[model samples]
Target chain A: MSLIIKDLYARVKDGAEILKGVNLNIPKGEVHAIMGPNGSGKSTLSKVLCGHPDYEVTGGSAEMDGQDLFSLSVDERSRAGLFLAFQYPVEVPGVSNANFMRAALQARLPKEEELDAVAFYKNLRARMKQLGMDPKFTARAVNEGFSGGEKKRNDVLQMMMLDPTYAILDETDSGLDVDALRIVSEGVNAMRAPYRSFLVITHYKRLLDYIRPDVVHVLYNGRIVKTAGYDLVDYIEEHGFDFVKEEHP
Target chain B: MDTPAFNDADELSGKLRLALEQAEAEARLREAETPDRLNEDWRFGRPHIYAKALVSALESDTDNAGRITIQAPAACVEPMADDMRDGEMRLRSIGSDKILALHLKRFGKGICLCIDTVLADPIIITYETEGVFTPSTIILAAEGAAARIIERHIVRGSGLLVATRDIKAMAGADISLELEVSGESTSGSDQPRAMNITNIAAMDAQVRQLTRYSGLDWAREETVAEILHENTTIELFSANRLHGTQILDQHTRQIHSWGKSTSNLLYKNVVDGSATATFAGNIYVAPGAHETDAYQANRNMLLSEDATINSLPGLEILADKVRCSHGSASAPMDEEQLFYLLSRGIPRHDAQMLVADGFLADAVTQFRGSESDGNNTKI
Candidate 1:
C-alpha cells in the first residue's frame, strides 16, 4: 500500500539527463517531503512520475499497490489514481473552471453511470466555499488571466475535487502570499487521510511548516542524498545546504 | 436565350441599363470578369461550382402591409423608377464589382422593400435555390425608422449562384440585417453564393450587419460600406464553417469618411478536412475623418493539418487621433490546451472540439450579442 520508486533515471527527450537513479517511498498513511535547490530535479521527478511527455524514463520502476505505473499512458496514469499538482497550472481558454472540473470528475465514472448535475454543483459549491473561493470563479475560463495566488488555489481546488490515491505536489507554494499559503495548506491538510499519501516537493521550508511531512529528504544532483525527520529543516535553515552537500559528497 | 428576361429597355432605367449593357458588351467581346469567373483559384482548397439560373420558391414576408412596400421592377413605375434609378447609379459607381453586374443583368426580378415607419414586427426573407440561381434584394429603411430584416439563402445541387443585397439607412434610422448562407450539394441543392453587399448610411444612423456561412462548398462573399455622415455607427460580424473540399474567399471594406463615427469588423473561420478559407479586411480612415474609431480582427482555426487559412488585415489611416486596431492570425489548435483537457480524461475528439469552440467563442459570443434583439420574425 504505497507508491514505491527505485533506481529512477530519466532525461529530457533527446536532451540532457535530469533524474539520476533516484529512490523514494511513501506508505499509504505517511507524508514525505523532498527539498532541493534549483537544477537539482525536484520538479523533474514529479513530472516524470506523472508521465509528462517531454521527459523520458531511461531506467526506473514505479508502482502503486504493486501495479506497474510505467505501463499506463499519461491519462491512464491519472485515471489510475495518480495526480500531480503542477507548479504552473496551464490556462485553458474557453473551458470554464467548473466545466473543466466536471469533465475531470465525469471521466472517472463508469461508462454506464450518469453524472448527477444537482449533486455535482451542490458538492462543488461546498468545496469552493471551504477553500474561500468565490462561486463566480467556477465560470471563469480555466486559469486564463488568473492571479498567481488564484491559480495556486485553483490547483488545490482541483486536487480536492480529484481525490487521487497518491498525490505529488511540485512547488505548490511558490509565488503565493502568506494568506494564500495558509488556504492552500489547509486544503491539503483537510484531504489527508489514512489511506491517501502525499509526496510534497518544494524548494522552501515554509511549505513544510504548513503540511508538516513526517519525513524529510534532501534531493541533490537528482538523488535522495540525505534523509531525516522534520527537524532537518531547522538544520538546513540555520546552517545551509553547502555543509549537507559536502558531508554527502 | 441570350437576351436576359429582365432586359426591357423602357423598364430598366439609370445605372441598371448601363450595367446590363456593359455586361453584355463585355460578354460579346469576351468574359470580362464575370460573376461566374472567380478572380483567382482558391489557394486553400478549391471546389468545382457551376453557376446557373434556377427556378424555385423565393420565400418572403413583411410586417404592417400599410407601412411597407415590396415591389419588383415592373411594379416600380415612372416616379418611383426615377428614385430607384438614382440608387442603381450609386450602386454602379461604388465599384466595378462583377457580382453586382450579374445582379443587374441575369437576375430577372428582385424585391424592393421599403419601410417608412418603425415596424411592430420584423421582415423575414428566405431564398432557396436548386441548380443555378441568381437573386437580388434591396432594403430601404426610411428616415427615423427602426426595422430588422433577416435574409437566408439555402442552395443545393451543381449550380452557380449570383446574388446581391443593397441596404440604405436614412438619418436617425436603426437597422439590423442578418444574412445566413448554407448549402447541401448531395441533396441536389448548392448554396454556392457569389454575393456582393452595399450598405449606405445617413447621419446618426446605426446599422448592424451579421453574416454567417456554414457548410458551403464554394463561396465568394464581399461587403462594402461607408460611414457617410457624422455620429453614424456600423457593426459587422461574420462567421463561417467549411469542411470537405470547400473553399470560401471573403473581402470586406469599412470606410469612415465622416468624423465621429465607429465601425467594427470581426470575422472568424473554422476550417476542417481539406477545406480552405481566405479573409481580407481593410479599414480606412480618411483625412478629416477625426475621432474615427475602427477595429478589425480576423481569426482562423484549422481543425486539420490539411486545412489552410490566409488572412490579410490592412489599415490605411490618414486621420489624427483615430483609434484603430487591426490584427489577423491563423493557427492550429494549441496542443498544450488539448493535453490539459486530455489529462483530465476528456476524449480526444471532444477535447479538440472544446478548444476549437473556445477559439471561436469570443467572436461567436459577440455576434450573439449583436443578434440579441427582440426577433419577432417568423418565417
Candidate 2:
C-alpha cells in the first residue's frame, strides 16, 4: 500500500501557481525525503495534502491506500490517517496541551465510545517523558509561549499521540538547534513502525542524518527533477541543486 | 418586634418619595433624559426604549416578598436596618441616577451581611422574582476578615430586575463577589431584562468581583470602584456568552484616589448569532495619586458574521509616576487557530466552541486565581 500522487497541480487561492504536475509515491513502511531549493513548492505540497484552505488544487489526484485524499475535508483527512507537522505550529491560547490532545484522540473514537481519562493521562505523561518534555507542559496552553525547540517537540508529541498512518514533516527541522534537532529526530524515529510511512521534507542533509530516509528526491521548479537512493542526499550535499536545475531546464 | 425602625408603611413611603424627588431633581438639573444612542454611556445600548417600561414597573407597588432566598452563616446574616440603608444611600452612586432613584424608591427588604471573621463557606443568595424586583445588598467586611459572596439571579418569567450592591472592604480585608445571571424564555412572557449596579470602596484591602451572564435577553451592568487607601487592590472580571439576539451592556470605572494602589479590569464576551455586546471602561487617577498601577482590557470574540461588539477603553491620568493602560479588541475567531484545531481531527462546531471557550477562560482564570488567594488569606 502506498500514498500515490499523479500530476498534482495546486496554487494559492486567486494567487500564483506553486505546485505543478508533481508526482510521488510513498509506500508503507518506507521513509522518503524530499530535498528542494527555496520556493520550489515543497511546503505547498504538504499544505495541499492536508487540505489547507489557503490553496486550491486545480488538477490531478492523491490517494492514500486507494482512498481519494481530496474527497475528504481537512479534518477528515486527519482522521483518515493523514497528518502534517506544520512548519510553524500555531499557538492555541487557553487550551491546555493535555485537553487538546485528548480532544483529538476523542475525535478518533465512535460517538458511543468514551476515552479513558486515566489511561489517557498515563499514556500522555509517558509519551511526554519519552520526548523529554516537562510534565508542566501538559497544563500549559498548546504551543503558546513555547520556544522553537519546545514547539517542535510538542508537534512530535502530538504525532506520537495521534499515530497516523502516513505523516508529513514540513520543515520540522527549521529553527532547531543541534540538541533540539537530535531530540526531535529521536521522537520521530521512535514512532517509525512497519505500518507507518513518512514524507520528510527538509532543505539540509543534517536532518536526514538523524532520521535517514530510504529514498531522496530533488524537487526543482515545482517538479521532481530527480529521484534516487539515499546517496542523492550526499550528492546534493556536495554539489547542491544547480546541476539538477540545469538538467531539468 | 423590637421597636420597628419605621412606625408604618406611610412613613416608609414618605422617606422613599423624598429620595425619589431628590433623584429626579438631580436628573432634571443634569438634563438627563432616558439614556439613548446620543448619550455617550448608552451609545451602543438600547436601554432608552425600555426606560419608560422600567420606570412604570418601578412606579407599580408590588410586594416581592419570599422571592429571595439566602443561605448564609447565621453570624453574618441580619436584616438591613433603616440607618444602614440611609448610610449606604449616602455613598457615591455608580449608575445612572434615574435607575438608582427608582431602585431606592422601591427598595424595602434586603440582607445586611457583616463578616467580622474569616468564613470558609460562601454566602449564597438566589433571586427568583418577576416584574420590577428591586433588592439592596450591603456587604461590610471588617478589618482582617475574608469572605466570598455569590449572587444568582434566575429569571423564570418575563420581568425587569434592578439590583444594587454596596460593598465596603476595610483595612486588611479580603472579599470576593461572584454574580451569575441566567434566564429562560417562558411561554407568553415578554423579554426579561436585568440591571445590576455595584459600588465598592476599598481601603488597604483586596477585593475581587466577577460577573457572568448567559441566556439573558438583555442585561446592563454598572460598576464603580474607589481606592481609598494605599495597598488596596481591586480586580474586576466578567465573562459573558450571548446568543440569539442577546444584548449585554457594561460600564466600569476605576478611581484611584490614593497613591500606591492597584486595580485591574478584564471583560470578555463571546457573541454568537445576532447578539451584541458593548463595554465602556475608564481609569481615572487623581492629581496626587502617584504610583498608581491600573490596567483595563475588553476582549470580544464574535462567532457569527451578524454578531457585533463595541468596545471603548479610556484612561485619564492626572498624576505622574503612574503606570496605566487600557485596550479593547474585537474580532472573529482566528482562522489559523481554527485550522490548527481542525487539523487535529476536531469537528468544525466543536473547534469553534473550544476557541470561544478559551477566549473567555482567561478572565475566569484570573478571577479564580484571586479567589484561591482570598481563600488562603483567612486569618
| Cα lDDT listed for each candidate | 0.73, 0.87
Docking tier of model 1: it is acceptable
Per-prediction DockQ comes to 0.48, 0.79
lDDT, residue B139, model 1: 74
TM-score values for chain B across all models: 0.75, 0.89
On residues B156-193, what C-alpha lDDT tens digit does candidate 1 reach at each position? Answer: 66444556667777787777777887775675343454
lDDT per residue for candidate 2 within B1-379, as digits (tens), equals 5854878899988988877965655454244355556667777776566555666677675665427889899989888776664544544443366666666655666778999998887889998757667888889999998988899987656767778888999999999999998776776445888888888999999999999987678888889999999999999999988988889999999999998999999999999999989998999999999999999999999889999898999999999999999999898889989988888888888888888888898998889888887644431
Candidate 1 interface RMSD (Å)? 1.6
User: What lDDT is reached at residue B326 by model 2?
Assistant: 95
Q: Give each candidate's fraction of reference contacts reproduced.
A: 0.53, 0.63
Model 2 residue A190 CA deviation (Å) reads: 2.3
Cα shift from native, residue B317, model 1 (Å): 3.6
Which residue ranges in model 1 land beyond 4 Å of their true spot? A111-113, B1-32, B35-96, B104-163, B172-180, B183-203, B240-242, B318-321, B368-379
Angstrom error of the Cα, residue B184, model 2: value is: 2.8
TM-score of each: 0.80, 0.92
